[model samples]
Target: MKVMKVAIIDYNMGNLHSVGRAVKHVAPGGTQVEITADPDFIRHADRIVFPGQGAARDCMRELETRGLSEIVREVAKTKPFLGICMGMQVLMEFSEENAGVECMGVYAGKVNYFKHLNIAHLKTPQMGWNQIQQKTAHPLWTGIKDAARFYFVHSYYVEPTDQSLVSGETFYGLNYASAIAKDNVFAIQAHPEKSAEDGLRLLANFMQWQP
Candidate 1:
């Protein structure tokens, strides 16, 4: 049998060690997990895990600087691709960040910032644990409860043109599409590496996921 190979795309940004460790911990014994920016290896891998953080414009710049933007869009279409945090946000066509920035365009959407909230307590960069209300059934949601909380640290969230693509939603100041799924692509705005039990389960499910 062919051993499963997972590529954690490296663009010289985000928490690579934590994301890599989390995936390795949950993946089956023989599965291979490689952290790479190389296009050839990435395209050949059976699965792809994209984890990112920091500013939206910077993220796109790095992906482009490393010549990985198009490669990511190409492989995502044919393989089981999982995106996390800023990784999820950049899948959109454009973003209302740093004036404006074009993205990978894997999905028809825009990444919007969390505007100022009326509540004195609520704020942008919705850091900490928040519940993810599953909007659609999916393999990534396996073993995780409907309202399970996941770790998140971001000021922007994605808005897909197609509501049917949303697999999960969360409310900071208002409800937003916190997760999306379609064909071989699945993305979440939460940080599964930092999340505890339920988060690990989600990673494990990704390991066995066929889609």
Candidate 2:
């Protein structure tokens, strides 16, 4: 049987092993998950999983440093792309981290810090399990119940200019886009690898998603 290649992009930002293991765990019998930063390998993969954890400035710097910025932009335009955490933030136009930083600008949005909000006193990162309110139907949310809790660890959240792009929302102090999808690109602010059963189920669905 032929194998489906899934690439977990490694741009020297975060741990790729866990993401790779989760993909492998849910991948069907002929699916192969490769963790790499090679442009050739990424361009040729069947699907791309971009996951990261770090400041937006650092992440973008690493991507450019490794000469993967354009590669990522190209893959995102044509493949079933999944961006997690910092991966999701980089899709926006700019981030308010490290004073300010320019990003991939795939989506017309900005990443903002979750501070000084006059809501419930929540921590800055909004870490731990949080319920994801499904805003629209998508293959990525298949079999996943509404308000399913997922693991999140971040001090900033994505605010897309087009609200229709938001596929999921979660309330830390205020309701913010927890997931966004457009065409072949789907990004989530949470970490599916550490998100347990529902998270694994989402990954499994991604493995079979035709889009």
Candidate 3:
């Protein structure tokens, strides 16, 4: 069997290893899960996974400092790229998480913090499993059942100016976009690798996606 290389950008954030492990399990053996900063590695890979944690501003700074911002932009514009968690948020133009910071600008929007709503009575940092409401069908959600529960752990979320890009949504203190896709870039605010069967199916679907 042939192996397709999948590169997971390792800019010192999030559970990169877990994402790589999950990809490897679904990929044919000998397929790589490279944790690298080399532009060549990213350029040559069949797919890229940007699994992110921590603050959006911090992730942006690291991408800039490592000169990865330019490479990532080029890669995202042309290849199959997936963003997880904060990885998804930073793909937008800005984030409010740190008094506002400019992001990759792959999508036109700003990241906003979750606010308390009188009706929900939920706390911020809406952690734990939440049901993802599928708004549209795409190859990424091919094997994912509608209203599948996925893991989430964040206080802020992205609000895309392009509603057509939103693939799924979920509720916390309020309803917000849980996943987004634009051209070659695909992202999900939830961690599919941690969501068990449904999440794993989502990951598998992504691995099998073609441009």
Evaluated with TM-score, which candidate comes out highest? 2
The TM-score between candidate 3 and the true structure equals 0.94
RMSD score of candidate 1 (Å): 1.2
Per residue, candidate 1 scores C-alpha lDDT tens digits across 72-183 of 9998899999999999999999999998998888889999877734556667778899999999999989989999999999988889999999999999888999999999
Tell me the lDDT of candidate 3.
0.85
* TM-score-best of 2 and 3: 2
What is the C-alpha lDDT profile of model 2 across 78-143, one tens digit per residue?
A: 999999999999999999999999999998989998985645667888889999999999999999
Ranking by TM-score: 2, 1, 3
lDDT of each: 0.92, 0.93, 0.85
Instruction: Indicate which candidate wins on lDDT.
Output: 2
Error of 2 at 138 (Å): 0.6
Better of 2 and 3 by lDDT: 2
